[model samples]
Target: MRDLFEDTATAFALKTDSELERAYFLFKLIGNEPLVRIGTAVTNFAIKANLPVERLIRATVFDHFCGGTNEEECLVVADRMFEKGVYTILDYSVEGQQVENQLDYTFEKTLKTLDFVKEKDAIPFAVFKPTGFGRFKLYQKITEGEQLTFLEEEEWQRVVNRFDKVCKKAHDLDVSLLIDAEESYMQDAADKLVEMMMRKYNKKKAIVFNTLQTYRWDRLDYLKKLHEDAKREHFHIGMKVVRGAYMEKENDRAEEHGYPSPICPSKKATDENFNQVVTYMLDNLDLMSLFAGTHNENSSYLLMEQMQAKSIAKNDPRVWFGQLYGMSDHISYNLSDRGYNVAKYLPFGPVKDVMPYLIRRAEENTSVAGQTSRELTLLKKERKRRRI
Candidate 1:
């Protein structure tokens, strides 16, 4: 069979010649580890020094990767993707805010995104990190079983209230919400809260989705356990599965804390476990909804093949494919063209506030074997085809 991933024309159709060249240049830059390290250091220094670097960053990586700096600005990008049969999931990408006011601002921003998606069928989901709504220390404390003082107890209650408010809004609007997975230390708290939301709002359908990072060795068993609970409680389970980010941080923290790593021992192990979970979810499709959030071509193809074998409808509401915006256009567009439900995780925020997200993207592309090279090859092919 011909490879759907090789369709450069469909993948790059939204790109102009200059955008294609910029993408090519950016991937080439990321492929060099030393250059990326130096560049990241210099960029951080420039930002801290209050230098005028936003324009330079905006003209290059920011434009290629992010939707815009705010919700209204993202509509154009969402419309463009909708025209191509792909949907959007507007994600507010700000991070590391700790003050109460900042946390409240993050919660309000998320509500705004949810409100924006309420009437926009092209935007199927809204997502936020749990840490965005509360202090990371609070989650870690709760996870570690640290007793909270009177003040701390009140703060934790506020965190719960914020989550309930957002999830209630999502349920009322009939818009799905995705709660992102964070690091292991704080993840148990997040998972518990997300499960609570799932039980409350997902009783009828998967209005609230919890993300599962399959790179963790324990996630498969966790999924099985969650499924059992869902069946007993009579609520549908909604999940987005990815191979996982934060692998280096997870391993480093494990070593520092003198704990066995939660991650899979090898890449092959992670891949096999991801596929196994995908198969398991498909087998129980009647009780769950799944979104395969991956950039890996093989994983995408595997999900498609399984769907076909199970005779699932091409646009099944319970099965969807997702990739981050500005990456894996080949998979997103091709799958949508082939009538699969597909969406891009379109992140938006002020440039400075979103730098952490951008930095992680750069690091991910640099570290993932063959990722940048593949992107470079596809951009080059398209540029050559257009004779640009």
Candidate 2:
């Protein structure tokens, strides 16, 4: 049971010898923490200086991690992965812009992606960050319960309009929309907006899915309360449960601002929190749908066990397992091979605009205990099997 993800043949079936070696090389580089830090700094400087690093980047980490520079290019990659029975989520992962035009562009992109998801059986979900649809400060202010000036109030209305437009389009098109969670400070506002969308769009089923970052100690309680509200209001709930990505930044901001950290105190606690949330959602599957977003093998096994115990079918539409596009082939491919619903988040954008996302991937691989090693180990096993 524990060795299900240990099958290198199924895991690396899509990777050629060259692609396998590239993955090995990238994981090796990412395993060195100091090298990753230095590389991140250098990459940021080069991108800002307008140096000719795009070609280099595109040929390496960009090609390995992202689907492509745009949706058209990404479709080629998405189609290839779909051949292996793995589904994709076309994530518009560009970062670091906060203007009205950029916000509107992201909103339009979400609408466009929802149309794509509607047409393609390979793609199951459309996703976007809250800040991608509006300015971060505006969400932060609302989260803090600050009064909005007249103009600010109007701007906030545009943000709400963007959320409504995308959610409505998804519902009309019969596509599931995933709203990603961001920093804890601004998440409250996003939560309220997502709840409104869920109430409006999830009447039939979960067309609008809100992300629950279970690394936060308070999230399980939050979900329980939200469940109460949804029960009273007669609306179905959809949630994507993830261990979270912003741990270091979250702890640092909490310390600097002299507030208690919102994060669970330890990795074990966070993992337990994640499992508990999954269990709660599974226990209440009649009223909720779950997208379990994880790379951890233990959690995956736990979900598998729970499903079997509950006598749930492997192809149940109400539950899904998700991983990032490039980072967890073993889990993604093996699960898909076994007929479970699985999707990979395939991020795509211009090189410069997407550098922040790529850099964060490298840093996360570097910081997370044993993640890079696990990737390296599997890639090495596949290479040896291929005699490469």
Candidate 3:
């Protein structure tokens, strides 16, 4: 059972030789910390200077990482992945929105995606970042319990409206909606808002899913409290558990603000916390639905092991395994091949607008120990097998 994920032929079966080489090259480039840093700096400058880098970007990293510049363009990728038994979560990865119009644009885009996926099983979920729907400082203020001015209150209501619109649409259409977890300081407001949505729409099942960054030491407590509320209120709980993406930013902010870091002490501790939380969720599967968002083989194995131990079905509707589209085909394809519910986060946006997300992916690949190396190792194995 453990060896199932090692089947590279099944993993990369859809990748042509050239695409396989491109992936190997991208991972190889991402493995170098210094190179990634310089590349990010250069790319940011080019975008800021209004340089014609979109075509070049669209030809390289953008093509590899994102589906396309819009929802319609994402269908090709979504359909292809669905053909192989993996589902897609269409992610509008545009960043740094500062105006209400842009927020509405994201809201409308999310609504449009929900409409597109309403009748299509290929796309099971639609996702959006909270900061995309509203300003970061707005969430920070609410999270900090600061007083809101009258106009600020109106602005907050608009944000709430955006959340409600999407969650309600998702519920009405029976499509699951995933609200992403952001920085620790702002996540409190998002979590509360998501819990409210869950209470509203999850009476029948988990239609609104909140993300839990398991790297936070207190996430287990949060999950327990959520479970308690669900038990009392008769609402289903849906949570996507990820190791986390903002460790450095979180630690730095804690140091700057003179607060104890919310992050776990070390990777081992975080992994343990992740495992423990998943165990808790599986143990209480009756009222909670889990979206295990990870690329770690051991964590994937642990979930499979627990499912078997609990006599759960592989295609269980209450459980899912998720990975980013371009990063973890091995896990995504192999899991779906074995009949597990799986979804890939297929980020899509214009090249210039999506650079921030693309850059972060590069930086994350560089910073996360062993992730890039593992990709390289697998890509190399597949490449050698094809004598490429």
Candidate 4:
């Protein structure tokens, strides 16, 4: 069988020799766990000490991972991706925001991106974290089923209002909106709010998407229940299936709280559950839309094969393959070249604000088994092909 993702030349065709070399070095650096830890700590210290490290960071990791610092800057990357037959999901990657004003700013920024994408075919979806629009503590409180004070009740209403406005805008513009999942503590409120939005905006088609992290042992069951609910209620289900981030945090929290861990006991189990959910969603394509948001080559190939067996169209609007903007160009570009619907989660924000996201990416690449090694191997293949 011809491997769909074997075209390293097409994957790296847009990269200059210097860019390719930089990526090679970056992945190599990330693959070294000790170096990554030391570098991350040093970078944090430098930033806190007000040292001049932003330029170096931007020139390397930031430039590779993020679209740019703002929407206007993101257009350059979006245009390039569109030219290559891949779509963009403009994600405002700012994190750890707590103030009401900050949350309001994040909400307006998301609406702005939604409006921006309405005029641009290059950008297919808009995404925002639930934490971006409300305080994490508020979500945790709601998840715990705690009673809210008068002021907290007012605050909760504000969060709901923000969600409604964003979902309504996406509905009006006919653009898909992805609500990102957070940690387990904060995810219940996010799931409830996202479901409410789905019920309202997904009446005719999937205008709202809720992310499902399949690494959790219960998520597959949750998906089954959500599917049943969608069928009974006569609405569409839009989901971005991922193997979940926050495994360490989720497990740590569970242990601290004297609860059994919600995460899968083994990576093999997580992979199985992830693929099973993918199969279930594809089997019910009429009632659901799916975005297979993964960097795993085997999972991507499985989805392709399943689509073939089911005779799904390559450009089906209800199905998409997604990866982070810079981490998996091999999957994104090669899949796009093969006429599959593909999108990159192009995150953008001011450098400082998006550092947490960048650090997480770096850590994830380092910690996820074989992720950095795979990237490095592909880069080397491409470089060798180019004889650079």
lDDT of 1: 0.92
Ranking by lDDT: 2, 3, 4, 1
Q: How does each model score on lDDT?
A: 0.92, 0.94, 0.93, 0.93
State the local distance difference test value for candidate 4.
0.93
* Per-residue alpha-carbon lDDT of candidate 1 for residues 211-326, written as tens digits (9 for 90 to 100): 99999999989999999999999999999999999899999999999999989999999999999999999999878999899999998888888888999898999999999998
Pairs clashing within candidate 4: none
Off by over 4 Å in 1: none
Count of clashing residue pairs in every prediction: 0, 0, 0, 0
RMSD to true structure for each model, in Å: 1.0, 0.8, 0.9, 1.0
Which of the predicted structures, 1 or 3, would earn the higher lDDT when compared with the native?
Answer: 3
Error of 1 at 102 (Å): 0.6
**Mind sharing the TM-score for model 1?**
0.99
Error of 2 at 43 (Å): 0.9
Pairs of colliding residues, candidate 2: none
Candidate 2 Cα outliers beyond 4 Å, as residue runs: none
Q: Please provide, for model 4 over 23-115, each residue's C-alpha lDDT reduced to its tens digit, 9 standing for 90 to 100.
A: 999998999899989998999888888899889988999999999999999999999989999999999999999999999999999999999
Candidate 4 has its poorest 10 consecutive residues by lDDT at: 1-10
